[model samples]
Target: MPKDTDFLYVSARIKYLETKLLGKNDIERILDAPGPDEALKLLNDTEYGYDIAEMENIYEFEQVLDKSMLRTIRTLKESFENHELITFFTLKNDFHNLKVIIKSMILGKDNGYLSRLAEISPEEIKKYAEGERAANIPDSLKAAYHKAMGAYELTKDPQRIDFALDQALFDEMGKIASTSRDPFLREYLTALSDLTNIKTMLRLKKIDGDIRTLDNALVNGGSLPKEFFKEMFLESSQSLIEALESTPYHQIIDEGITQWESTGSPSVFEKLIDNFMISLARRGLYKPFGSETVIGYLAARENEIKLLRIIMVGKINGISSDMIRERLRDVYV
Candidate 1:
């Protein structure tokens, strides 16, 4: 493992970049803007101004958001010499493209707008799917491709493909974190895995989904055992919450599940889980030097982009600022 001192130069530079991040106030200003144009003009004063200008209109916010994400990925790739850490951080998009390409092949539709983050072309995945070797794609993705394809063939269910790929994603994340040599990053991934599993369990129960589906949907790498969820699979939400009583997630689960029980929707807990992860990600910010800073900054960038999308969607649709504010997630800055 590299010593903290080894990261001094990169960490210092990241700290300076962190200062330029949009604060809660900046987000609120955009949220409070009278309409879409006003809200966009407010964003124009920030770092996204240049990208927004390139957009034909404010409704193209998703493109601008994607540009922001691309810039962040590019910036981190350029700034950090630790390619493994960067790869681990950005691996989700690669998996996302895998899902798209595989599904598109199944449906005979276009594989649209895959991110260039992985540098592994769509044709590479297609060739590998056809039993030809493609070296550009990661071994993990190649394995996931086979698993998802087989699962889809067996059940003819697109969701089985999602289940297979999602578990592969976390399993691969666990593999990376195990070798990452950063204890907190591993724990961070664990928290995410746990939360995802928890949500899957609660969601399945809410919709009266089969226990076997929950079994297939749950991923490893979380601290809690898979059997831990299976034990309470047939129980009430309260029972599930009680099963989690001694864990750190009890409160969030308590609140999120309670709301979900009443709302007939998963959005509340979904938001809470995101909030929980961002708070967890904040631990990386205080580290003087390490991969932690890189991880923390990347988490901030993701949070910012997510929140911007929420605000923009609400703004363009004529949703009021108060309503939009309610939908906004906590800002990292």
Candidate 2:
């Protein structure tokens, strides 16, 4: 844990920034906006206004959001003494950019959006992906790139790239969480791994994927044993629900299962889990000072961006308010 004094300045800045986040009412107004232009107008009164005002098209909104995220991360990095804690929040973007670059090369097209949100430059990642090795790139990421490329070469399967990089991402996150020795960070990462494993299992089962594929897809260092999920793979959905009942995610899983049974759609499960994660992230607000506040602020900002994307897309596509609301995740504020 960091000393309270260490977070004094950063926490105050984060708290003030939190006030500018979109509340439920702001979200509703945005949702109820008559058109994409109207919705974009609504943002002018909020922190996103400046970014959205000069946008040429709806698709360009992603750039605005990404810029906001990069700005926030940069601000935190500049303000905070404990840079490692801030790095934890941005590492996923680095891994994501790596995945995009690798996949784009394999596909022979520029399908990737190189995010500035990452700690590492996209050009450096592109160089690494193009068969040039960099001394500055993390060894684990380098290993992941080589392994993923090797897998793709052997199997000629493009999806292997994503699988390899995702595994590496989780492994790196677990290492960072352990090094930090922050219980909240550890638990949060553990839950993420567990939920990821669960989601992967459920998705593979839905597709009748082979046991080998399922086994390879599972990430380690989560709260549950690998064998536990493997054993549950043979069980029915009800049994899966029962098995999860004793875990921290019992309620969310149970509700998701019930919804799945009724609707025969996995989206309910995804939404429930997302809400659960957001709820956990929101708990960081209770602490006046610590890495939790920083982590929570980042998570909240990310979710806020996600919500904006969903709402804007829906408005642009003429989707109904009710449908958009159903897709909206829980607001941090």
Candidate 3:
């Protein structure tokens, strides 16, 4: 457990940083931008101004975003005294970069495209990937990675690889949090676990994923019933809603099912769930004394970037603000 003094300091820092997140109007402005260059002008008006100005095109926008985020994450980690905390923060990029590489190779795209992948130093990730040093992975992580890697080999489906690796990393994160003395960190992990489980269940139900397959995918420790997840395969979307009626996510799942019925597209439902999760995290950050603030800030920052990217794309495609708003994730004013 970290000392009380350290927690207080970190929380204070997080509180100050939370003020930097993009507001709702910022998103609307980006969506309303006339074109990519005009969108670039809006970005230039923000703290990310310099990064946007340097980008030669929209493709470079992603690179600049990656660099900025990684720089921010590293800056945050530098404030921590614990090597464990720093390492945990660093691994966020490790898994992300690896996934980028895996997906790029599968698509036969230029690996150089990853040069601007999530904000961790690309050079560092490349060094780690190329180095002969053994991974400093925990025993639990090593086992899960081995399983996911094996699953990757057995099924060439990138989605499978993504899910397998996702479950693996999350399980390992849980294992680490379990040993931490910080209540805020534990609570953050618990919230994350719940969100992940809910999202997985929704997607699995949509695909009518098999019972055994759902069982494998369902992470432990969420509010969802393992039995319900197993049986979710035997039911339809409506049945899933009925089964989850007692849970916090029941209404969410129901709303998604309803939208699916009306729009004949699941994108609305997907965006709703995403926005709900973001809203949940944003609300949780009011706590001024613990890791929730830290984790919440990180989550908010990532979503802010995601929202910008979404609006940037919408601008490039000349999509209407109404259409883009439908896809925007929730953001605090």
Candidate 4:
């Protein structure tokens, strides 16, 4: 763990970088651009401009975003003394890359979008997925790799790779949060895990999935007990709302249920989840210096990248501005 003084310089740097985040007006400008190329050109005036100005297609644009994300993580890691705090963010990319490798192996294809932001190199993950065992891989990840491979071999289901990796990801996140002894990080992870469980229940309910499947997907360490979700499974939307009423996420869940009832879109719930996360991240702005500040900056940056991706993809596909705006998450600035 890092002391308050450890973050003095880095927090100042983060504050400066926070100003570079895209504002609502900037997002609108990007949305209103005539074409993908023109919209991409708008990035030039922002922090991402220099890195992506020469991007010729969506693939290149995604590559540039990946590079930018990696650059941010590297800069923060070099600036901060607490590598564990930084690893909390980087671990997601590692799990993502692992999932990609597992799926690619199952499909007999070499295609996968590996993010450079991961703490572990993509090459190493690929080596492990290819049956080469190394002493360096984390024990949990190695166990997950083996389990996922075994499941794939038995059932030949690609989705098992996702299920296995996602479970391992949450488990790893829980460990990091506990080891860091940061209240805010623990609360954030708990909320995230609960939200994931709720979303899974709702989606599975639509398909009439059994309790066993739902139980299998639920991650531990969430505030909501597994039994709470298990009982809520296959129940009415109103029951779901009632069950969540005591939770901090009650309002968002209630509103999301109403929106989902009327609009029949899962994006409503997802948008609310993003907003909830952004609100929590925004709270860190009041702190002068701490791990929370760094966490907030990383969350905001990731959300910014997600928003930009949505806008660019919508513009490229000729989606209506109103439609795109409806899908956009809240701006951090």
Report the number of clashing residue pairs per model.
Answer: 0, 0, 1, 0
| TM-score of model number 2 | 0.95
In terms of TM-score, how similar is model 3 to the real structure? 0.82
Root-mean-square deviation of each candidate, in angstroms? 1.9, 1.5, 3.5, 1.7
Q: Estimate each model's TM-score.
A: 0.94, 0.95, 0.82, 0.94
Question: Whole-model lDDT, candidate 1?
Answer: 0.82
Candidates in order have lDDT scores of 0.82, 0.84, 0.65, 0.83
Q: Model 2: residues >4 Å from true position, as ranges?
A: none
Of 2 and 4, the candidate ahead on lDDT is 2
| Pairs with backbone N, CA or C atoms under 3 Å apart (clashes), candidate 3 | 70-119
Clashing pairs in 4: none
Pairs in clash, predicted candidate 2? none
Task: State in Å the error of residue 105, model 4.
Answer: 1.6
Better of 1 and 2 by lDDT: 2
lDDT of 2 by residue, 138-172 (tens): 78778888888887898888877777878888888
Worst 10 residues of 2 by lDDT: 129-138
* Candidate of highest lDDT: 2
Arrange candidates by TM-score, highest first: which order? 2, 4, 1, 3
